[model samples]
Every structure is written in structure tokens, then in C-alpha cells.
Target chain A: NAGVIQTPRHKVTGKGQEATLWCEPISGHSAVFWYRQTIVQGLEFLTYFRNQAPIDDSGMPKERFSAQMPNQSHSTLKIQSTQPQDSAVYLCASSLAGQNTEVFFGKGTRLTVV
Target chain B: SQLAEENPWALSVHEGESVTVNCSYKTSITALQWYRQKSGEGPAQLILIRSNEREKRNGRLRATLDTSSQSSSLSITATRCEDTAVYFCATDSGQGGRALIFGTGTTVSVSP
Candidate 1:
């Protein structure tokens, strides 16, 4: 298995521009999660989806950041009018079940908002 | 403040030596997990210890959890260069749905 596949791997965008990150979860996995990693914040959960439905997004910023799971196979995180502070590694993970299951993560997309 | 925090930002050890990393959490949790992330790679699960379980072992890795103190530990025996990575402790929020709260992580360097 390829585990989880995240596209682009790295992205650089001018401030105020939009950035979109994609993740393709492993086959048969039911839960997908998104997290942001930075030196200051460590690893923070942004949102999650189960069975193609958004379960919780309590950690996501109210503005500029949004996530969508259009299908069970893939999900996307979009940041509009990206700011320098938005730069961080966006990680996507999947688990076989919703709770108490081993989670597998993708390499992550390193976003540089300049 | 982070719900969970790992002690010792970084540590170094020679190959064949043993290393231990500690983690403490503020709130109650149903389970705690240990993950390791290598350079340019995503974190991978090492072990999962539930609140009821005090200790669990996987190969040369052992983890201990103290629910009363809300602390956990991971020990690796006979470390190798391949084991050099950043280790993190994640706690289940106990609200269910497997929402994990992660710690800052401990950077471990195992050298030859």
C-alpha cells in the first residue's frame, strides 16, 4: 500500500493568494483527519471526516481555512488569502475505525506562504 | 496550554544504549499513543496504551501509563540509528471519535 498520498508535497504561494492541499486516504479507511504542524504550535488538529462526512472542525480557524471531503477516497484543505502565519506542514491521516485504531499519516504538504 | 506535554525537548544516545521519553497530560483520557516521525515523513504509530493498562510492550519498545498521575513513558532498548526521530505522545480526548491531542514531541538521536 502507498499509505496515504498527499499531493504536491510542497507549495509556495504569495500572501493573499489561495492554497489548496489534497489528501487521498488509504482504501477501506473510514476516518480521515487533518492537522497542522509548526515550531510554535507543534501538531494541532484542524478537522476530521468520517465516511465522507465532516465530523468535527473545532480546531480550524473560523476564517480563511476550510476543508471538504467530497468523497470517501479523498479530502482537501483550502486556505484563502493565505498569510505568512499560515505557513506550516499540513498532515493528513487515516484510521481504519473512528476510535481506538492505529492512524496512518501521509508525508504532508509543506506550505510556504511568502 | 497543551493538554499533553512531553519532557526533554531533545536527547541523544549511542547505538545499543537504551532511551526513555516521558509525557504528562492535564485532562483525562481513554488512551495514549506513541508516534515517531522521521525527517520529511509523517508520524507513525509506535504503541497504544489504554487507561486501564499500565504497561504494554512491542518488540524492544515498552510503554507505561499512569492514569492517576496522567503521565506515560516510552522506553526503547538497544537503540539504533534508524530509531533516531521525533517521538510524540497523543491522548484520546475521551469524548470519543478518536480525536487525538498531541504533545510537542521529544527529539531522539541515536548515534553509532
Candidate 2:
């Protein structure tokens, strides 16, 4: 298995601009998840999808952050009006199912909003 | 949000020594997992101990789960410098399709 694939391993965005990150989940996996990691906060869950339907997004910031899984194979996370405080590593992961399964993670996209 | 707290946020040990990291979680869970993440890399699942199981082991790594106390521990025996990395403990709550709630990681440094 290719594990989970995420695009644009590194991204640099001007302040107030937008950035979009992409992820291709492992084949046949039914669950996809997004997380944000930083030196200060460690890792925090942002959102999750099951079978292409969003299951929960309570962890996401109420403003300027959004995520979508248009199909079983891929998901995308977008940040609008990015700020320097938005700089962090965004990671995507996939698991065979939602319960009692081990998750596989992508190398993550390092977003630097300058 | 349910919290998973890990202790000894950072530890430094010499190669060949043994080290242990502890974690505690709030709320019941279906399973608890241990993951290792290298610098500048994604985290990888190392072990998953269901609530019913008390212990699980893989190679040089061993994990113990205590559902009664809502706690878990990951231990590395005969550690190698290559094992140096941040380790995180995550919980699967059996809800919301098994979304994992991760803890603040324990950074381990194995000196050569």
C-alpha cells in the first residue's frame, strides 16, 4: 500500500492569501482525517470523514478553514485569508474503517503563511 | 474535546537503556494506540491495544493499557539512537467513525 498521499509537501503563502492542501487516501479506505501539528500544540484533530461524508469538524477553526472529501479517494483542506499564526504542518490520514482500526498518515504539507 | 495527556514531555537516554512514557485519557475508548513520528515526518501507528486487552508488544516496543484507570504506557527496551523521536498516544472512542484524539507527544532522545 502507498499509505496516504498528500500533495505540495511544502507551501508558502502570503499573508491574507489562500492555500489549499490535497490528500489521496489509501485505496479502499473508507475514513479520512485531517490534523494540524505545531511545536507548541503538538497534534490536533481538525476534521474527519467516513465514506465520503463528513462525520465531524468540531475541531476546525470556525473561520477561514474548510475541508471537503468529494470522493472516496481524495480530500482537500483550504485555508482562506491565511495569517502567520496559521503556519503549521497539516497532516492527512486514512483508515479502513471508523472503529477499531489503525490509521495510516501522510507525510503532511508544511504551510508557512508569511 | 476529550483529552489525552502524556507525561515526561521530553526524555533523553543513552543507547541500550530502557525508557517508558505514560499517557492518561479522559472518557472511555474503544482502543488506544501508540504512534512514533520522526522529525519532519508523519506519525506512524506502532500499536493498538483494545480496552479489554492489558498488554501488547511488537519487537522492541511494548504497550500496556488500563481501561480501569484510563491510562496507557509505551515502553522501549534496549533503545537505539534510531528510536529517537516523538511518540504520541491516541484514542479511538468508537464514535464518529473512529476519529483519533491524539495526546501531546513525548519527545525521546536516544544518545549514541
Candidate 3:
């Protein structure tokens, strides 16, 4: 079902610039999640959406970071004034709305801030 | 510290050999899942062990859960080169709308 699709497999941006990552979740899935992966932090949770509504964003950076799911089909994560430390692979996952369901992930978008 | 964590940060093995990865969690959970992520790819689920069950098996993989100890382990037999990847253990609290908490991951390398 195309699983999950993340646009711009790789991205490079200058520090202090803005970068946006896009994710298209699996069809018919009601839950979508965003995560950042790095060697030091591994897979760190950033946020999630249920039925197009944000559920939790406790893992997200309170400043310079934001995520939105305008519809059930797609979501976006944006960073303002990106810094070198913000570079990492951003992963998107989706699953049916339920407890302990299998979550399918996309290949991820590698964001490199130079 | 992470809510879930894996030990033996990295390991190496030969084809046809076996290996085991262990994990420990700090909180109560309804299920523990094992995921493998290969180079340039996203993590894929290999096994899911529930709190009520002690062990679960899938093909050449076996997963064991110990609720009292808040630990779990994933064992792979007759490993292959394609088995090389980073394995992560994630815990699901079973709370409504809660996300699965992932571990740091253990890197496993299998050579021919």
C-alpha cells in the first residue's frame, strides 16, 4: 500500500534556515507518528496524530519545531532557524487506531543542517 | 535514561551461528516488541511478546518476556549476512493513545 511515504529522501539546509519534512501515511490508517533518529539518541519520539488531530507532542522541542496533520493522509514537521544539532533522520510511522497495533514506518528523510 | 533499553550495544557473528539481544524497561507494559533496522531502511517489527505470555516464536526468531524483571530478550538462530542490523526493543504501556517507547538499540553484524 506504498506503506508510508516521506518526501525528499535527503535534504540539506544551512544553519538558521527553515526546513520542512513531509510524510504521507498508509491509506486507511488513523494514527501517524513522527520520530527523529540519530546515533546518540536512537529513535526519539517527537509527536503523533490520531484521526488528523494531534494527540501528544511532548517529545517535540518546545521552540523552533512544529508538526501538523491537516488530514489523515499526510503530516508535516517544520523547523525554524535550524541548527547543526538538528540534523538527523526524521521517520514517520502509522498504524490502525488501537492499542499495541503494528506500526509501519517509512524509509525516513535525512535532514542535514550545515 | 530511556524507558526501554537494550544491552550488549554491539555484537558480531558468523553465518549459521546464533546470537541473543537483551532488553530492560523501567515501567509496566502490556507488550514488548523487537524491531530490526537495516542500513538506509526503517525499523521493521520482528516479534511482539505480550505480558501474559512468557515466550513467542517466529520462524528462526524467539522472544522471551519476564514481567517481574521488566526484561525481554530476542534470540536468532542460524544467522545470515542479511541479519546484520540494529535491533531495538520497544515497550507499549497499553494506555489509550500512548505511543510505544523505544530502546537505544543493539547493533548486530553477521558475516559470511
Candidate 4:
């Protein structure tokens, strides 16, 4: 298997600009998850989807951050009016059902807001 | 958010030394997973132990889960320089089948 695929491996955006990250999960996986990793916070959950439907988004920032999984194969995480604090590695993972299944992670997209 | 706290933000040891990382969660979980992440890379799953299980081993790595205490530990024996990385513990909360809350990672540095 090719594993999870993320596009635009690196992104650089000016402050107040919008940034979008893409992820293509493994085929047949029904659950997709988005996480942000930084040196200080470590790994923080941003959101998740089950069967292409959002199940929980409590971890998402109340503003600017949004995620969508339109279908089983792909998902997108968007940040509007990105700030310098928004810079971090965005990671996407997929699992068979997400309960006890092992999640396979993508290489991740590094976002740098300058 | 349910907190999964990992102790000792960083660790250092020689190649032949053994090291252990600890994780404690605030809530009950169906299972726990251990993952390793090198700098600039995504985390990779190393072990998964369900609530009912006490210990699980893979190669030179051992993982123990104590559901009653809501905690888990990961141990690496005979560490190598290649084992240097950040390790994270995630808990399956048994809700929605979509969430796995993660802990602040432990950065392990194994020197040859």
C-alpha cells in the first residue's frame, strides 16, 4: 500500500493569508483525523471524521480552523487569516474504524506563516 | 479534552541502556497506542494494548497498560542511536470511533 498521502509537503504563507492542506487517506479506511504538531504542544488533535461525517471537533480552534472530509479518499484542513502562531506541521491519519485500529499517518504538511 | 500526560519531556541514555516512558490519562479508555516520531516526520505506531491486556511486547520494546490506574508505560531495551525520537501515547476513548487523544511526547535520545 502507498499509505496516506499529503500534498504540498511544504507551505509558506504571509500573515493574514489563507493556507490549505490536503490529505488522501488509505483506501477503505472509514475514519480520518487531523492533528497539529509543534515543539511546545507536541501533538494536538484538531478534528476527526467517521465515514466522512464529522464525529467530534472539540479540539478545533473556535475560529479560523476548519476541516472537511468530502469523501472516503480525501480530506482538507483550511486555516483562514493565518497567523504566525499557525505555523506547524499538520498531520493526517486514517484507520479502518478508528476505535482500536492502528492509525496510519501521512508525512504531514509543514506550514510556515511568515 | 481528556488529558493524557507523559512524564519527563526528554530522556537521554547510551546504546546499551534501557529506558522507560510513562503516560497517565484522566479518563477511561478502550485501548492505548504508542507511537514514535522523528524530527520533521509523522508519528508511527509502535504498539497497541487494549484495556483488558496488561502487557504487550514487540521485539525489544515492551508496553504495559493499567486500565484501573488509567496509565500506560513503554519500555525500550538495548536502545540504539536510531531510537532517538519523540514518543507519544494516544488513548482510544471509546466514543464516536473517531477520537484518539494524544499526550505530550517524550523525546528520547539514545546515543551510541
**Ten residues in sequence with the least summed lDDT for candidate 1 chain B:** B92-101
* Clash list (residue pairs), candidate 2: A98-B97
B93 in model 3: Cα distance from truth in Å?
5.4
TM-score versus the correct structure, for each prediction: 0.98, 0.96, 0.98, 0.95
Q: Report the poorest 10 consecutive residues by lDDT, candidate 4 chain A.
A: A95-104
**Model 1 residue A21 CA deviation in Å:** 0.3
Q: What is the interface RMSD of candidate 2, in Å?
A: 1.2
Off by over 4 Å in 3: B93-97
Query: A16, model 1: CA deviation in Å?
Result: 0.8
Interface Cα RMSD, each model: 1.1, 1.2, 1.1, 1.4
Candidate 4 clashing pairs, residues 3+ apart or interchain:
none
Alpha-carbon runs more than 4 Å astray in model 1: none
Docking class of 4: medium
Q: Give the per-residue lDDT digits (tens) of candidate 3, residues A1-114.
A: 788999989999999999999999999999999999999889998999999989988899999999999888899999999999999999999999887788899999999999
Q: What is the DockQ of each candidate?
A: 0.81, 0.79, 0.76, 0.74
Clashes of each: 0, 1, 0, 0
- How much does each candidate deviate from the true structure in C-alpha RMSD? 0.9, 1.3, 1.0, 1.5
Model 3 clashing residue pairs (backbone): none
If you assessed candidate 2 against the hidden native complex, which CAPRI class would it receive?
medium
Would you give me the overall lDDT of model 2?
Answer: 0.91
